[model samples]
Target chain A: MIKTFTRNDLIRYIYQETTKEENTEIENALIFDEALCDELGDLQLTVNGLGRIERSPSKGSIDKILSYSKYYNMNAVN
Target chain B: MRKYSVSDSQLISLYKNGNEGAFADLVNRHKNKIFTTVYMIVKDQYLAEDLLQETYIKVVNTIKSGRYNEEGKFLPWVTRIAHNLAIDHFRKAKRYPTIVMEDGSNVFNTLEFSEDSIESQKIKEDTHALLRDLIKELPDSQREVLMMRHYMQMSFQEIAEATDVSINTALGRMRYALINLRKKMDKLNIAYDKNLYQK
Candidate 1:
């Protein structure tokens, strides 16, 4: 019996989150399934679009965590 | 001297044994990822910082209380904690899904700066700002899944566990989020990377 992948399965494949066995199946399907391959490409690009605007917290944010850790250590010691 | 090359599990064990700088090492390693993850959800730098501090404090308490068994999975574990805290803040205040406009302005706010000067930088900033605004426009549930999947970089399984949804549901939300984002971008006539949709 052939296994049919769902929309969810396509998403998992696009995100590279599938198991090895599932990946094999998806790859085999993608080889012959032009629509499926296009879906994967579109989803990948959509995910990529989200990545175009990466933001990081400021240095002061890191300092806040460090200071909190220091305080926790001091309190633990006393 | 601390073995700086050890795994997160080893560092965690060293911290458990009251090593001087082990905890600091761990915090330094994961701080930015944790902070950025929270900031993405909260959408406010100051509030995100506060939540980041709270997240660490909870981590400290959990470690001291002997309940933290997660070793190698430290980053995901703490990230879950941070994500939950952000949600909790929203629930407690009942003010979440609120679009935190930087200038307290309306939505559809556009760039006001000169297009001639620093064109590249301004375009980049505007793109990010507009995208941020679009994300804010998503329905709360869809937005949550999108943020966790993209910002936290969590797996569907991890996202399912964190949000208490099934993996299938998580995947569906992600799929819908992409579909919705595409539809919104089309409706707004916002130019995206067109090459993506062409092929």
Candidate 2:
């Protein structure tokens, strides 16, 4: 059986927070552990899928946001 | 025409200096994230839009009044505003979703968008719709963690701080969420990775 790493350890690995030597350990663990490796892959996919969602702000919306600035300043001076 | 590095601090500085357009530029740049962030909190698109607007308005108001201080990070500043407004809305309404159970098991999981054939984009739309349904099956905590981490681009540390959980706890939730999502995909025969799973 593959050695079980703590969830915190996995998270540390996910965020590149792992030290160089520890990073190698995680990689080696995955190579030896099927379930753990699959779990890591799943997390990778969820993050990738979410990252794929790009922001497409509507046109003219920025104008509205800017207008608020004008209104704020106007109110402040009054 | 000088691009000031596009950092939040630069944008906030520009906006505070009475550059109205700068405020708009910043909002436009981050509006989607703002919208998504608010949407995940409220789970209502229309209301989320309203709160999203309120967040920007408050930012404008704060900056114009010179009440906006240079903080740890400008992006987090606006996000904090958005987060507060969302929490306030929920408190006043006293309404939370049913699916978001105590244990954080709710449906708001996978969000995928597949491509169609060489014809029209109809199939792609269908894929998006299907993905939306799948996400609704995710537990509230999982969905929230997944969306905040993925969509809002918040780190686990940020999520922990924002959601009032320890980093380890947040990580555990996410890990379980992914495992649950994998099971859901399997049940539906969604074939998230047909090639890899086949072997």
| TM-score of every model versus the real structure | 0.77, 0.72
CA deviation > 4 Å runs, candidate 1 = A1-3, A76-78, B1-7, B17-25, B103-117, B161-165, B189-191, B194-199
- Residue pairs with colliding backbones in model 1 are none
lDDT per residue for candidate 2 within A1-78, as digits (tens), equals: 445687668766876667898888888898988877876777776544443233333344455566656777465542
lDDT of each: 0.73, 0.62
What TM-score results for chain B in every one of the models?
0.71, 0.71
Which ranges of candidate 2 are over 4 A from the true structure?
A1-4, A16-25, A28-35, A53-57, A75-78, B1-5, B97-120, B191-199
**Candidate 1, residues A1-78: lDDT per residue as tens digits?**
346788889888877788999999888888888888887877777777776555455567667666766667566642
lDDT (Cα) of model 1: 0.73
In terms of docking quality, how is candidate 2 classified?
A: acceptable
The window of 10 residues in a row where model 1 chain A has the poorest summed lDDT is A51-60
Candidate 2 accuracy as TM-score: 0.72
Candidate 1 residue-wise lDDT, B60-179, digit = tens: 878876888873378777888999999899999988645565643222122333433566444555655776677777887888888777766678898888789899999999898888
